[model samples]
Target: MNAVAGAVQALLVIGGAPLLTGLMRQVRARLEGRAGAGIAQPWRDLRKQFLHKETVRPRGTSEVFRIAPLVLVATSLVVAVVVPFVTTGSAIPPAADLFAVVALLTLGTVALALAGLDTGTAFGGMGASREMTIVALVEPTLLVAIFALSVRVGSTNLSSIVSSTVHDPSRVISPASLLAAVALVVVIIAETGRLPVDNPSTHLELTMVHEAMILEYAGPDLALVELASAMRLSVFLGLLANLFLPWGVATSPDPLSLLIGTGAIVLKVGLLGVALAVGEVFLAKLRLFRVPELLAGSFLLSLLAVASSFFLA
Candidate 1:
């Protein structure tokens, strides 16, 4: 039953990720007073990329460039199956440790960074360098922020963390939890290349981060990379939702529970995506030099969360 729940959870994320992206775009469009493309636009884009476009391999690129998309999507799929999105129990219990999950995400980041360098383009190299710097800060904050939660729960497994929260709702409002939540939100924004840290829509040579890295990709390869990006957004949103607001996640693998769990997660992540889009409307990307300061602030919050967890207990 745990395996069945994991399969359903994975399908939910893969199928809904594109829709989530489209929804966010539509929300931003509405707020910007434009009649936006419908929520199916991303799906249409992906279909066109996969079926009508030809894969282009740039000159002087290596296998890393060719394989990075696969690696990124593969790791996301693994996390989707192992993490507690719909169910508190995972198909692979041992693999759901918080450190393991964080490591998987970092591995995907490294693969994409290496692929960017493999392209040998000036923009690709610049983006890769910038991305690694962000990763160095973001990853540690992610670990420490979640570590604050684990300190109280007494386990590093994501399932255990969620389950503990589910059974003890009060923990959600604790000083440590609130601090960790803020820290994690910043980490997600930075890691996902959202506004104030990086702009997903921008292609300006001097400011683009994630886009510059993928500028050399086209056709099927581009589709995979885009799909993986959407998946990662959904995965991060799901983690944020489940880790902090895990009320509706299934503690058992019964059919009814699984159904509720699916709906709950979808609703939670959808709301988060909309909120993020709306928030981005008012935010301009921060200067490149100031990004480190923003990330440093998040790191400080995480440290406070950890300290509060120990001292306040």
Candidate 2:
């Protein structure tokens, strides 16, 4: 039953990811006073990409380049299944360890970086270098933030943390919780290639981070990469929503409860998408050099959260 429930939730996340991406694009377009593509546009785009007859592999690229997208999407699906998207209880409880979740995400990033380097293109190398630098900074802060929350629950398991916080909302009000939330929000924006870190909509060669790595990909490869990117974004946003505001997640295995939990997560993630769009509209991307500073600030916040958790406990 746990495996069944997890499979269902993973399917929901993978299927709905492109919709979330489309919705965010539409919201951003409207905010900028332009007519937006329909919320189904990402799905249309993916279909179009898939319909293309061939994928052009760049010269000197290896099997790693061809397989990176699959690795990325697979790792994200694993995260979706283990992250308690619609329930406080996990299908695979041991997989819900916060460190394991972070490691899986890091593995995906590392695979992409290797793929980028495999292309031997200047843009690819540059993007991969920048990405690795960012990840190196982001991962520790991410772990520290999770550590802050875990301290309160006495376990690093995501389901355990969510259950503890949900059962006692007072934990949500603590200094550590607030600090960790802020740090995680910063990490999310950076990790997801959102504005003030990296812009998802731009292909400007000089400014592109994520886009640069995928410039050589086309057709089915591009579709898979794009879908993986969307799913990754959705997973991060869903984690943020359910972890911080776990109000509507199911604690039981009943059908009705799972149905309600599904609806609640969709609403939560949708509202978060809207908020992100609005925030992006008001903020400009930080300078490439300045990005390290911003991440450093997040690291400081995470460290403070850890300190607060220990001292205030």
Candidate 3:
């Protein structure tokens, strides 16, 4: 039954990812006063990509080039399993410890960066270097934010945090809790390669980060990378949804409640995705050098939130 629940969550994340990406495009387009491609645009894109000839790397790149997409998709699929949407009763919920989740994401990132560098292209190397530099700043903030939450809940295990937050409403207004939420929001934008951090819409290679890493991928490989990206977006947003807004999550094992919980999770994720897109639409990308300053402010806010929570508690 646990496996069954896990499967349901996985499929929901996989299928919902494209839709979420499409919705964001729609939202961004509408906000900019144009009737953008409808919400199913991502699906249409993937189909076209699959049918077309894949862009290949110059010969001598070795198998890592081919394996990069698999690594990216596999890691994201694992993350989807660990993120709780409908229930705290995840089969591998313990694996959702904040540090462990970050590690999984980092592992995938390293593989992508290596693949980018292996391509031996100037653009690929530039993107990988910038991406790693950003990750160096991002990893610490993520840990600090999660550590604050763990201290308050007395456990870093996601299940416990959900229980504590859902059981008590006052925690939401607490300083630490709010700080983590804000920090994670900044992390979400950066980690997901969204606007004001990285623009997903731009084709100019000079401005790209994530796209540069996959510039050599073609066909199903590109599809996997794109799908994995959508999955990553879903996982991060789901984590935020379950972490800060834990009320609708299921504590019960009943199937009916699980069904209702699933619907609630989708609704919450969709709304968050739309809000992020709208935010991206209004903001321009930050100067590459200034990114650290923004992340540093996030770190300070997270620390302050934790300190406030500890004092208040």
Q: What tens-digit string does per-residue lDDT give for candidate 1 at 75-98?
A: 999999999998889899998998
Task: Return the top candidate by TM-score.
Answer: 1
Q: Is candidate 1 or candidate 2 better by lDDT?
A: 1
Q: List the residue pairs that clash in candidate 2.
A: none
Per-residue lDDT value at 197 in model 2 = 97
Model 3 misplaced stretches (Cα beyond 4 Å): none
Clashes of 1: 0
lDDT of 3 by residue, 89-159 (tens): 66687677878889998888888888899899998899999899888888888888877877878888877
Whole-model lDDT values for every prediction: 0.94, 0.91, 0.85
Q: What TM-score goes with each of the models?
A: 0.99, 0.98, 0.96
Ranking by lDDT: 1, 2, 3
Model 3: lDDT to the true structure: 0.85
Tens-digit per-residue lDDT, 119-170, candidate 2:
9999999999999989999999999998999997889999999999889988
Q: Which residue ranges in model 1 land beyond 4 Å of their true spot?
A: none
Ordered from best to worst TM-score, the candidate numbers read: 1, 2, 3
Worst 10 residues of 3 by lDDT: 49-58
